[model samples]
Target: MVRPSPTLRPLLLAGLLLPLLVGCRYTYLPLIPAPAEVALPTRVTSAALTREGGALVLRARVEGRFEPGYLSVAWFDSGRELGRDSVYLDAAQREATFRLEAPEAGAYRAVLAFGGNVLRQVELYEVEP
Candidate 1:
């Protein structure tokens, strides 16, 4: 029978134990919960246009982790739907921003849809000339 040299024996032992040590080190990491399919908007803010005769730009910040899908933006003016814009997100993003130009001088609602669900809805008012 042949025996491994002293230096080679220690090297072989370390190679065998490497995987066990790495696995145990990661055992304490808590598993993060999967984001909900339908997450409501957590925070929202709106501001009026500062310049006169400038179009009102409604900006919104929506927070959620949506599945790989398309996000749609809809603009509503005075309880009536005006227009919509859609964008595709291939991977998960922590948040998203949407902007819509004011159609007329009035109150407007911006709705964000993700995976066929309404993720956020915000209201803004446009001043008249």
Candidate 2:
């Protein structure tokens, strides 16, 4: 049987442990922001949330020329999802509105998403009766 010499054994052990120690350190690279030209087209120009009596209303103004698609507004309460509402967008439609029953008085957020990407979010706090 062949065996490593005493001097070679220490070198071999150091070689293996050196990589383990060095690899344990992680270096994260900073994210590069996307250029404005390559950014997603702004289909929704503005969105607002309002409470009307017993319902929450979402009014989003859309401005762009794109193929017909669906825009969705998902309601969340303290990180728990309540429900989602979607509206169809045609070429001629200039705005989208969604009305949903208001949840119990609490903090809520409405996320506006299009093409699987989030475009805007509106936070609303409903006062207790």
Clashes of each: 0, 0
Q: Model 2: C-alpha RMSD to truth? A: 11.7
Span of 10 residues, lowest total lDDT, candidate 1 = 43-52
Instruction: Estimate, for each residue in 29-68, the C-alpha lDDT of model 2 and write its tens digit.
Output: 5556556664347567888888888788889976665567
How high a TM-score does candidate 1 get?
A: 0.47
Give the TM-score (vs. native) of candidate 2: 0.62
Clashing pairs in 2: none
C-alpha RMSD values across all candidates: 13.0, 11.7
Quote the positional error of residue 59 for candidate 2 in Å. Answer: 0.5
lDDT of each residue in 1-129, candidate 1, tens digit only: 999999899899999999987887555445776677875443323322221343444443434444566667787777888788776664454334455555457766777776777766766665431
What is the Cα-based lDDT of residue 24 in candidate 1?
77
